[model samples]
Target: MKNENRRTFVKKAGIGIVASLSLSDIPAVMTGSVPDRPEKQEVFFTTGFKAAEVTTDSVILWTRLCGQEKPNPVVHRRREAIFRHPIDFDEEMPVGSMDGGVKGIGGSVKVQLSGGGQILESEWHSADTENDFTVRIPFDRLKPATSYRVTWTAKLPGSDALHTAAGTFRTAPQFSSPDAVRLVTSTCQYFWSYDHDERGFRIYDSMRRLNPDFFVHTGDYVYYDKPGPLGTTIEKARHQWHAMDGWPSLVDFYKGVPVYMTKDDHDLLRDDVHPFSPAYGQLTFGDGLKLWRENAPIAGKPYRTFRWGRHLQIWLMEGREYRSSNQDKDSASKTIWGEEQKKWLLETVAGSDATFRLLFSPTPVVGPDRDRKTDNHANKAFETEGNWLREYLSAQENMFVVNGDRHWQYVSVDKKTGLTEFGSGPVSDAHAQGWDQEDVRPEHKFLRVKGGFLEIAVVPSDRSAAVIKFIHRDVDGNPVHEEAFSSS
Candidate 1:
């Protein structure tokens, strides 16, 4: 038989068969300097490479594997098996699952202190095809108010060559500590193509200079609606994610700083999509939700809270899941946050002792949406719940709402409740559509329609009070507007 046929037979037969084969049975090519077998090339990471869910002592590292060609058949078969028998998190249905045809790569992660001391090294962890060849490495028992560097090396199947990536993150400060908390927030990043614009995502470069503890991507991180119909299948959605990750700017940004992300209507399927929205082509809300969870650094549900020292408490709300249809009747019973999340929000607010409480919403809770009647809290669709929330927030001191979805930036206070709300403008200048200029509102303090981000600084003051400074910076990191308030 030819050398190719012999090698194929050898691969199919067990290693025992290979040992039993005679030298004569093996073709002459096997004995030559150039082996008859072809070597599998190493696969590298397409994107991801981010840190999330960072706490005083723990942070989750995320990454995805990619290759030049389709994955090996073995990888697809194994991934299908995992899909059939999905694993749940704490008895909840699996929020994410990998589809077939994605390669699974084995890897190890090494974490070290910023100054170069090794802290933790993980054993071999497979970036299994089951999770779309994505891996989350959790580093625990870390010190508070500390920075760590994480590095990963991945080995391709049947190959000795390795691929690698590295990132850094700083853990949250200890509870009630006097350490200042710095955070940056932005939304509406609609980069359909990497080279669509000339600047090529320069905003991220500016953001890296600011060196905030973490970034809050309120929503529209990926625009699934534009450029075409939303992806319906796992593979398609995963492809979109890989394409977005291919961007050099995003890759560099996530590698340096951790991010907290939430999804909006565009990221899901269409504008104002709910659980019951009519399917576009084969795409459904459930598919979008799965893709969002799978690609994000989060493990289960997106709604969660983060506390930084005693000065800052962040409530990241899930405005999409469990929301009523936008076409639903605008009655008192109509809901956006649903009952469970609303209850949790109220209870969490009532019990929190932090000096500054920030409610991060995917959509503006205090907005008119450029005179459009939409499903946001400012619209009549959710007036009843909106009023209740405004009233509840009115009674609470040192509370603010920071929102995305609207491309423009503005700081507005609730007319009745006096609750202040800050809007983080779009990250892409091209997506800064509608509201060419900030509209004059009864509570409007600052308005800028240009693309920029919002930065919040919480610093200790004399006595028991803390000063919170809100500054909006242009895409190049120059401060365009600023607002300040005191919290006691």
Candidate 2:
């Protein structure tokens, strides 16, 4: 058994719908109304284990340990190391256990235990005292598309026996050029209504039917609604998230999609909230940063890229959050993709051989966020002005940009090169907003502010060209827009 004293593993961090025309185009509200969801009664952490961060070969597993309480609220405040683990498993394994044996498998601090092929050595580390009792383990050397069982235990101070739970997980398929792959991309799905069932969700349900390879969440997954009786300050925004239960309905939708997400203003704090937002220069930065990390799977580096087969490579950027000064409109020093991220993005794209290079920017990589009614830095610099990416786009013919934030969707073509930019937004907000719909230059191909997820079906062909069809849908699962683009 591992040392029960050194159990706290401290670090942390952390949808859509459709619609269409005709009978199916009718909104969910007007359709044969679905019954309201049942009220959530007691949530006593009845669920013991959860897992995430699944890769082709490895996954990060996590679970919680509870303390004594009719409700166990004390466990939520103290971050301590009162955890344990077994070295073996029995036939009747519980739902959330990782360790195998009942007692110390060997020594108190020095022991070897095996489960999923690799042996885990007991490393005494302090666990967080004030939070959910949890531990993260890297299941290494796991085979692709195979399932494995794991268990864990946490021995309370002075207790001889250990508390345990067990669960199983399967790794993603191997990555030697998949025979087939598809992706769905969109953003701005704010969630607070606990209904779990909604018109917005029907879109996600439909997308799942297509069974995409992997989904990309451009940003604005959670909207911290504000401007209430509470004071209008940055701290207020930070507190708003904790008050709103942090993660929203969008989070639940992604749980089933194996999604990759970036952050937008809503997820950060409010509409147009930036690093220099009133509270950012103060102490609220740490709290805000901590909360964002705790609730989302934002890349530590913020902007990163991933490749799929030889046809597509995705580059995602953190448009906001990290910045020194925003008032200096022309200051190149005022960063968007922070220095490191910018270099990595350029180098990755420059060296990539994929047929289509996709960049997922939270805000529009082309126009102003009309919803915010301001010249959002993301649009002005990253798209219109001479930013690093604006230049990079000119040199690559097969590259395209996808974004979310303005609560609208548009397919714009570069007047000069005929390059297209697609954008989606506010996947679940109450009302649809209008973009400069009338300002459709010959360069503008499509734009709509309807609520829905962008359905991206990517078909790889043996004949060099890959066909990607972009289908737009609304709340009731109706397809409203369809356009196809291909690259060789």
Candidate 3:
């Protein structure tokens, strides 16, 4: 059979079989040597395979099982649990864990060291029903600054057929190591059925060629409110995620390198969403958060920090959660990071010893908003808190901000404080609605309203100062602009 026909046959034959399969039956199914089979046949993997939350000693591997007959019962139970206990509104419990009976699609994960050829095979790790058959397999006790290959296998529940996926990733160097770290950052990916151009996601191919240590997806990973044939519900959200995962370029990019993701307004709901805002059409904040958590391989608290060698320390902040209502007045009480997260941010910056502290903001922190909206930290609505943060950062030795959400790319510097910020352009060529190149601020060192990504190279130095180079590359991997800064 042809490739597409074979995939169709395997998908049709594999429906509703993931739950009944045993781990022991996967090896034969993978090798196409199942006992009593007339001819060799292989199982096909689902579209949802990627890696995330990589660290010096660990990395999270993920994949989803496709061709399910119906939604998993655990998903319904988890939805019911969210409805019963709306944790997003509850201040006491900022986050909640989903747990229930064992409704898992059995699978196995194998990790291999690239150079040493040491193979670490894991026992079956279930694709949980609550997570839409998505499984996250973590590889721990790994060496720092090393490369590894990860492979996942699963058998069709009733049949002796298996599906497989493979990916690669490199861990961060130790905190004291002087190794350099390369990172790519971008955001604002809006996929609509009407927009069928293949070039929309071609940037991933260029990103893979650069071979960055990791990619930081600032937000808009998916537009939950965009009109699609998929119905409005949590299931629709899962379908959207699966659709994005199925893209060939995206799959290839993730397989080459790991990603660090943060959620933005579009990814959560409609644009400019606030904490207490009403639901966007039929999707509630609770369901949106649940779907976001279920799809990604996040390990701990969403807002956390990562230390890359002795030169770079990255702070990934949560912009949506704990934010005050958009209708609130601009005061000290009107917060974005909430009290606890704000405290942590200040403490982490004060205590950090790295050469450069890079803060990742989902939205721009310094701006000339085309619209007079205060949803982002740049607006006057956050003046009080923003001023405090600016003063604190200015007092520090070496600090910078990297932001997304704006469809245009620009490098802006605060005139008074001398703090620099880099904005990663949109993933698609489309500009933000009601905004254009004319709206870019006067302080912008560079601005472009096209599709591109930011590549930052952190080079450690024998002296106290470290050199950081920012190369802005277009979709085809050509450097359109470049800038360098030193951190002491």
The candidate that wins on TM-score is 1
What lDDT tens digits, residue by residue, belong to model 2 across residues 190-307?
3322113222244466566656666777776545442221213433433333322222233233334455668776666555666777553233544555556554543356676766
Question: Per-residue lDDT of 29-94 in model 1, one digit per residue for the tens?
Answer: 766745557555556765648899888888887777765333221111111221121123121212
Query: What TM-score do all the candidates reach, one by one?
Result: 0.81, 0.65, 0.80
Question: What is the RMSD of candidate 3?
Answer: 12.6
lDDT of 3 by residue, 49-136 (tens): 6667878887777777655322222121111221122123222221111111112243433334342355777766665467767767
Span of ten consecutive residues with least summed lDDT in model 1: 74-83
Q: How many clashes in each structure?
A: 0, 44, 2
Give per-residue lDDT, candidate 1, residue 435: 74
Q: In model 3, which regions exceed 4 Å deviation? A: 1-43, 68-117, 193-200, 229-231, 431-434
lDDT of 2 at 347: 80
